[model samples]
Target: MAEAAVTQARVRLADREGFLAWIFLTPTVVYVVALVAIPFGLAIAFAFSDVTAGDPSYDWVGLRNFERVFDDPVFWRSLWNTLIFTGISMFFIVVFGKVLANILVADFRGKWVVRFLVLLSWTTPVALSSVSWLWLLHSIYSPVDWVFRELGFIETNTYWLGRPNLAMASVIAVHVWRLVPLAAVIMMVGLLSIPTDLNEAAKIDGAGYWRRMFEITIPLTFPLIAVSALFGAIFTFTDMAVVYILTRGGPTNSTQVLASWSFLRGIGGGDIGQGAVIALFLFPLLLAAAVLILRAVRRVETI
Candidate 1:
């Protein structure tokens, strides 16, 4: 009798929509808790404690770490660089991604190859791609320089990663290259989901491509654009791998950002508290960006 009752209860629970929703979400919830929640909580605790990589002990230190991070000139430089890096990357990413998405949606021959090539940068492992870029941007033996020289654009090889401005530009360029495919794919989905009837009707009404795009297409896809921007901001704010691999925040720390700076201080420099403090600063900026972007998405037309 108990076994029969248990079976009936299980069937009822499985049939319940809310219960099924949680069941489907169980893996994601567990993953987030184990990976994100725990690490974030520990970081918060470590921020207020005098923890170091050498000594794993957590000793309460109040706001000393925050004070130190505030006074560090490198921290200010990293903060500035982070803004510029994320801003410039996001601008070009969205613009180029939109253009690429338009091309992707157009009827063409051998589009499968184009799509595969476009996705290569995003799908490739970051470390591997960064290393490849490092070779391409090498002080000597750069094919990019060869192309430029052959075109009469320059007479000699340019130091892509050895100067402050050029290093920052190179890092931003690589980061944008890696991310644009993802943004393009996302915008492509939004583009595809746009109803064809709308475009057709607009064309019948004598609306040109630009007019229809501004009036109907862009309005509908604006939300997804914001979503892509949100993802870009998050990736930009948290990623340190490219910076670490390509330039190592070199050229006099010109390409340093909060994410790489935190990693450098917390792990490499062996100051856990300071590193955690630096990391915590990222949360507010991210939160603000997310809130603003999400708000914009919510207010726009749904795709």
Candidate 2:
């Protein structure tokens, strides 16, 4: 009878643990279903339906919305702009972030202060930061333009947001500035995780700084860098606040990216179906990028 009681108690304990596990998982499951899954389903539905602001009722339009989006040159332009923005931002974010991480990894006086400074752009609200950048690049009162004029780089204040190329460049610059800090923090983590003994052994083996960095430091840290690049690309690709606040896709829609264009079409232009199509375009591209990056990381790990 005692043995039977013990076995029953064990079963009860196992059941309790399983219940607790499910309890912990329930919130996350519910949240994803409600916020992510449900919205995604709605987006898919709306993309195929003729959804309008005045009418909650929608008719099944099939691929008509996507067809319209594909035919629009503005859609193609926005897609190209998004690619350019993401690509350029990723390149510079990695390069500068890696350098900053290397510097911060070294022991130094007031290193904490430097670290705080590095995080300023990231910690500040993006909208506020973008607005500040707009002011700094303002045509008449721009501090950057004033400094340039003082240094004779140009004779007059430059209209940064007025010209198409300049507006695109400014948008890209702000994006890079905003994203670099996060990249640096990621790089710092990668740098810190490197075994000290391995680096010391490399030093003892007569591996010079650049040689060790190129051969050992980079290869091991490359996987983490790729992760940072992936995140930066996603952020740049989906981000619209900076572009909206800075240029509103102005100067002939030169700075317009996919996300902003979607907003402009769907909400701003009051064509919900077309907006859904534009928004959905990001899904496949992002999925492809994520799959490729993760596969590459796995391959590197196997090596």
Candidate 3:
């Protein structure tokens, strides 16, 4: 009888454990289905359809929208801009972030204060920061202009955002500034996790600081750098905030990227189908980057 009772108890305990596991997973399943799966399906449908914001009806166009996107100069230009923006911003973010992470990782005086200020740039909202940059880069009554004038850099008030070349540079500069802190924080975390013994061993073997960094620190922290870079790439690629707030894809649409172009088409130009196409172009590239990064990170972890 006692043996039978123990068997029954074990069965009940197993049942309860199974129930708890299902309960924990239920919310995640529902969330993915509702938010991601459904929206992604809708966006895909919109990409293939002739759904305009001004028109109340959508007809199945069957790849015609995509063809139109290919032919559009605006779409191509936005794609070019996005590539340039992502490339330039990623370069600065990685270089500066790695340097800053190295600095903060070392034991120093007032390190916390420096870190707090460095992080302050990223802590502020993008909209607010973009607006602030707008004012700073303005032609008249701009602080940057005033400072440059005082320094004898320029005699005239320069409208930085009004010029096409200067506007793109300004946008890229703001993006790099906004994104560097977060990248640095990510790098710092990875740096902190590295075993100190390895660094010490390298030093004892007559490896200089740069040598140690290149051979030991960088290779080990490579996964983190890739992850940080992936994040920066995605943010810079899809970012419409700085462009919208600062340039508005203006001065001949020189600063337009995929996101802003999508917004302009869907919201401003009333071409929803084309807008959806523009927005979804980044999706495949982002997914590819994410998959590659994750695989690299896993490889590092195994090593």
Candidate 4:
């Protein structure tokens, strides 16, 4: 009788476990289909159709929207700008992130204060931070300009966003600043995961700081760096709020990225079809980068 009861309980437990698995998975499946899959399907349909924000109606246009996008010089320019923006921002993010991560992992006084300061940029809302940056870089009554003037760095009020190059640089700087903290925290986690014994043994064997960093610390931490970079690239590639808030892709649309340009055309210009096309261009490249990064990370993990 006891054996039979034990068997019955075991069967009940198995049934409960199976039910819970489906319960946990059902919401995620529903969310992806409703939010992600449906929107993606609609965007593809819009890209091929003659859709407009003003009309909310569309007809089959075949390749017409794609042809129009290819014909526009702004599309190409935005593509180039996106590459430059994502590339440069990622470069600075990785470099500075590593430095900050090293500092974070070390034992020090007031480390929590330092960590909080570093994370402030990432924690703040992008729109609010962009506005702050805009104010700092404003032409008149700008603190940055005033400080530079006071320091004799420039004799005149430098229009940070009024010029094309300066505007692009300013946006890149802000993006990098925002990205580095997240990257730093990721790197810090990676640094912490490395076995402390190996580092100590290397030190005992007369490995200097730089030698240990280059030979031991870097190799182990490289996978984390790649992962951080992949996330940074995706965020920078898709983000529009920073550009929109800062310059609205101004100074002749010089800093316009594919994301902002898509918004400009699809919503602002009422050409939803072309905007969808512009937005979709990012999908393949981002997909490729993600796949490659994941593969590399997996390979490192397996080793």
Candidate 5:
């Protein structure tokens, strides 16, 4: 009787969709709580306290840290740089990603090898890749400078990461380079998921390639493009590795961003409260950006 009852319950549990969903979802929920939620709560707590690397005591400081952050000129400058970094990187990432995705989805010989090569940038560890770029852009014996000279683009060392404008551009370029492959892969999935019948019908109606793309492909893949953009924005907003590794916010903090600035303050400067304040600001900005993206996507869908 007991065994029969246990088997019946097991069968009932297995038959329920809700139970199955919770079963598969439990691990993800627990993972988010443990990693993301906990860290976020800690950051909020620290932002309101006087926590520091040296002090380590959590004394309530309220809005004092916020005031200090607002007063810092570097904070504002870094914020501007971060906006430019994320904006320009995202623009190129989307445009290049779409072009690459179209190429990727096309039928051709050596397509597999092309796909593999394209994914290498995304797969490579960021620090290792950034270090290689640093070597290329280093003032002494720069291969980029030599190549430019060979091509008659410059007469001397271009100092890619030395000039303020060039440094910002280099950071954005590297960021776009790293992210475009991932975006391409994402849009490729979207493109591949699209029903082939739609394209065939359009082709039968004498729609050219560009017309089919603008009408059918772009509309269907709009959601995925937004998804990729969100991913790129999150990565770009939170990322300081490229900036730290390449320029170290050098040439007068031209490449400095909120993420790097937060690290400089919290860890490097040992002001945990102010650092948390700086880092926490990214949350709302990200949230707003995502909301706007979703709204734009929805508006497009409606139209």
Candidate 6:
């Protein structure tokens, strides 16, 4: 009888454990289905349809929307701009962020204050930051403009966002400012996680600072850097707020990116299908990048 009772208790406990596991996972499953899966499926469907605002009608267009997207000069231009913006911003973030992380990892006076101020750029709201940048870059009252004129760098006040080249430069600069903090934080974490024994061994082997970094530190910490870069790429690729607030794809649409272009098509122009197609394009590229990075990380882990 006691044996039977113990068996029954074990069964009951197993059942309860199973129930709890499901209960815990239920919210996440529901969230993914509702938010990610459903929206993604709908976007795919919309991309193949001819959907417009207030039309009360949509027809299955097969690959027509995609073909149109390929032929559209504006779409291609936006794609180019997105690549340039993401590439330039990511370069700065990785190069400078790694340096900053190395510096901050060492003990120094007032280092905490400097780190906090550096991170403030990212913690600040994007819209508010963009607005502030706009004011600072304004032609007439801009401190940058005033300083440049005072230093005789330019003979006159310049509208930085009013020209194609300068507009692109300004947008990329702002993106770097906003994104670098997060990258630095990620790098700092990676730097901290590295076992000190490796560094000590390298030092004992007469490896100099640069040699140790290149031969040991960088290779081990590379996975984290790759992950950070992938995330930054996604963020920059899908970002519309900064561009909208700063350039509005203006100065003749030279600074337009995929997200802003999609917004213009869907919301501003009322062409839902094309906009959906544009938005969908970013997903595959980012997904591919993320998958590749994760695979590399996994390989590193296995080694």
lDDT of each: 0.93, 0.91, 0.91, 0.93, 0.94, 0.90
Q: Once superposed on the true structure, which residue ranges of model 5 sit more than 4 Å away at CA?
A: 300-303
Question: Which prediction has the highest lDDT against the true structure?
Answer: 5
Positional deviation of 141 in candidate 4, in angstroms? 1.7
Q: What TM-score would you give candidate 5 relative to the actual structure? A: 0.96
Clashing pairs in 2: none
What lDDT score is found at residue 137 in candidate 2?
96
Residue lDDT tens for model 6, 12-47:
877897787998999999999999899889889989
Q: Please write out the lDDT profile of model 4 over residues 1-303, one tens digit for every residue.
A: 999999998888778977879989999999999998898888899999987976887799999999999999999999999999988998999999999999998899999999999999999999999999999998897899889889999999899999999999999999999999999999999999999999999999999999999999988999999999999989999999999999999899899999999999999999999999999998987898789888988887898
- In order of appearance, the predictions have TM-scores of 0.95, 0.93, 0.89, 0.93, 0.96, 0.90
- Compared with the true structure, what per-residue lDDT tens digits does model 3 show for residues 213-257? 899889888999998999998898778999999999978989889
Pull out the clashing pairs in model 5: none
As for candidate 6, its clashing pairs are none
* Cα error of candidate 2 at position 241, Å: 0.7
Each model's number of backbone clashes?
0, 0, 0, 0, 0, 0
- Of 2 and 5, the candidate ahead on lDDT is 5
Clashing pairs in 4: none
For every candidate structure, what is the RMSD over all alpha carbons to the true structure, in angstroms?
Answer: 1.8, 2.6, 3.2, 2.5, 1.4, 3.0
Instruction: Summarize candidate 2's per-residue lDDT along 64-161 as a digit string, tens digits.
Output: 99999999999999999988888888899999889988998899999999999989999999999999999999988999998988998999878999
Error of 4 at 2 (Å): 14
lDDT of 1 by residue, 168-251 (tens): 999999999999999999999999999999999999999999999899878888988998899999999888999999899998
